[model samples]
Target: MRRSEEQFRILVQGVTDYAIYMLDTSGHVSSWNIGAERIKGYKQHEIIGQHFSRFYTEEDLNEGLPDIALATAFRTGRYEKEGWRVRKDGTRFWANVIIDAVRNDDGELIGFAKVTRDVTERMNAQKELAKAREALFQSQKMEAIGQLTGGVAHDFNNLLMAVLGSLELLRKRISADPRALDLLDNAVEAAQRGSSLTQRMLAFARRQDLDLQTVDLPGLVDNVADLLERSIGPAITIDMRFPARLPNVTADPNQLELALLNLAVNARDAMPNGGKIVISAREATVAGGDPDMAAGRYACLSISDEGEGMDKETLDRAIEPFYTTKGVGKGTGLGLPMVHGIMKQSGGQLVLRSEPQKGTTAELWLPVAQEQEITAPVRAMEVQATPEKRALKVLAVDDDALVLMNTVAMLEELGHEVIEASSGQDALGLLEQNPDIDLVVTDQAMPRMTGTQLLGHIKERSPSLPVILVTGYSELPKDFSKVPLLSKPFMLSQLSKKLAEALSSAAAAPDEDAAEAPAS
Candidate 1:
């Protein structure tokens, strides 16, 4: 019997995972096993006389949990729970613990037995799983929003094209009357602003085509300084600073300008009492270990505002779409989100720093590239070709009636033979029936068939027929070979430019691929 008791004691003392120990009736540790020492980071001598409460966190101890657990165990003969517990090194862990009342034959309590197991690893794994699930949900939500935004942009562009075309025609017809002309000009200006707003929405939705190229940061900031100053008014002072010979970055200059304008506007609003705005730029290196920045040289552009800054909670969610503190009708809550999308799409990073009562600073880190001077091509004076002599049989296709009529009017006004088709099928039939058709201009978004699909069909049959696909959404298949693109809401001059370019290319020797053309 004694040998068996000794063997059992040895088995209990050999454990190193669970913290198995004994506590006296007074709640002081009375005996310690090797498992207790290993799990709790304490030696037998050091912990034997210590109170069992030492294993609990301060918050638990303050709530008299040690005494309560002892009372529960003594009365009910057991206690079990899992929660955060402290170790000898002050590190906290999720721990599973159990206590049992020890007693004599008569059931009088003598002491208590305790066991604890650290479960921090399991807790961390669970947290990571939850985070991944949330991230997946957010990704799906953004994709849905993108689809919706693209559909709306397509419809909006059709309406805008009609409004813009009418305004352009009206300006010419009413130019003789100064009062009427002024009204037309104002309407045109408003329509242009609306076009810009639509583009901004596309930016936020990450659908806008980003024209990334080498850009001189110093020159860009200098050119925009006057505009920024005028826009913000004299009440707020504007300052510019740049390091000598800052490296050029790869970005879309126009989009960067818009982003800067957004930041300036936001800064101005933040400082309703008027304050200083500082625009600064420098070339810096992102270290390899940075989690958010790739290891490379970058042009760091920072905009600082001396205004009431955001608190921690606001700063945390500042980049979320449609989230804003601005009251209704004052903001669409897209400025920061759009800027953030721009940064990500540009292969860069955005850093925002703000503190309550202090000012805010927004930083854009654009990847730096090898120094390359960009030169613009000089155009020779064109012998003005009369549209009537250069006129070709043109096909204009669009689903919207008003837009199709506007396009026909514009084509006829340019002295070309206009053929109208409302569907891609109609366009194909027109091409089949009319062998004299010179060019095909088709809208991309349609009911049954898209312009790209129509382009493919036309190319298969008439290999050399020049096709121009018009779209507002700034994405297309990679294999859209040799086809030209024209953006919606185009004016006569813009249409003329695309047509002239396409006609010139079509007149060349048989080419298998359409020449890559820029959208106007």
Candidate 2:
């Protein structure tokens, strides 16, 4: 029975997953088991007499960890800890270790029993979980900011439109007095600047209308070469390695140029003392083999800077809205986020790679658009007259008093008779009174009834009446399939053009219009 008991103890000690061993009072390995061999990538012959400190990192060893463990075990009768430990192959692992002092009948220390378990996989999984949690938090915060920015941008655009529109009329009426013209010029410039700032906010919110087109990647880069050189001081060198032929990507040319400029400026900032920036372009195909990218032909544009790179934590949050490392007033923290939003809106992706000492690289992946589908020479707004006479009665609805008045004035200027409403409810009443109203232009967001709802009511009453929905908010309701939409703060010519097109289309499709009369 005694022999059998000893054999059973040995059998348990030989198990490979739980490393079992014995250490002397001085913390030197006295005996080793098969488990220790497997866990530490060692054999009994090699590690039986070695000091346990060999399993710890050099820093830990220098800190006298081996002696501390023995002292702790001696004082408390047992010691346990979990920390980084080295394996025989020079790899590090998370290890849970326990040491218990063993003594003889006389109460003299004999040895110590040690048990260790490899927990590296669990440690790594926990790290990954932490990263996922951080990413989720950032995404939620960005969504909240997006909603706030969108609303604020919408309101500001209405105000700017009113100011600019009134100015346009004033400019046309006033004589060319140098002083008056100069003052007007300044006001116009300020209003234009305000418009630009609002547009940037819209871009960050990903709500701006994109004039997407297929563009040659290299050509676009070349066009901005001079500007980039001027933007980044003469101390820094700008290098280009554009391929002879690159894939054409579908994107808004202006936005793409802005994105590139943002990236270049960021790169320049990183290199305060001046460094080289390499701009390169090439064609790439992401098949299933690449995990981060989708399967498609892509135009890859990369900007690399030999500057001070960001650490892991900073790089992770680099694209987040309002996250900037620069000093206050030095940065807005919206540039990279704007770039990210633009890429997402354009059906592309942006990725950043950086290391503490290895510098940084930003790559934009834009899916190649078909050559035939590419629009040539992007069109600007053109004023055209409608075939039908301007004698048609039009109803315009907007919550802003100034916007409504300005819109009415523009319509009257265009030789159309106009009826105005401060809200959707008022517009509905006017429409009910005059069923002969030829067109209904309504704002999307209003107090009582939304433009969408008002349009639905009107459609139900008269299917042939052309309805145009305008809003500073660009996103349309999902069900508004065939509805004509005009973005808010629009130029008078744009509004007139859109109104004409909607009316003409309605006139041509009388049969379909009657079938789907109600916009509900």
Candidate number with greatest lDDT = 2
lDDT at 163, model 1 = 95
Best by TM-score: 2
Q: Write the per-residue lDDT of candidate 1 for residues 329-355, one digit (tens) a residue.
A: 888777887787688778897799999
| Model 1 C-alpha lDDT versus the unseen true structure | 0.83
How far off is residue 515 in model 1, in Å?
A: 15
lDDT of 2 at 105: 98
Residue 402 of candidate 2: its Cα lDDT?
A: 86
TM-score of 2: 0.85
Tens digit per residue, CA lDDT, model 2, 1-520: 9999899778966698989998887778888888888889888789878888899999889898878988899889999999999999999989999999899999899989999999999999999899789767776787778778878889998998788777877787899899999999899898887777677677778887776888877878888889989999898899899877676898888889999999999999999888999999888888875544568888889999988899999998888767899999898787888888788788788899999867899998898987724566444534354535566688989998989888888777667889999988898889879877889888888887888898888878887788888878666777985688877676667777887888877878877656889867
Could you tell me how far off, in angstroms, the CA of residue 313 lies in candidate 1 after the best superposition? 4.9
RMSD (CA, Å), candidate 1 to true, equals 4.9
TM-score of each: 0.84, 0.85
Clashing pairs in 1: 482-514
lDDT of 1 at 325: 93
Write down the lDDT of every candidate, Cα atoms only: 0.83, 0.84
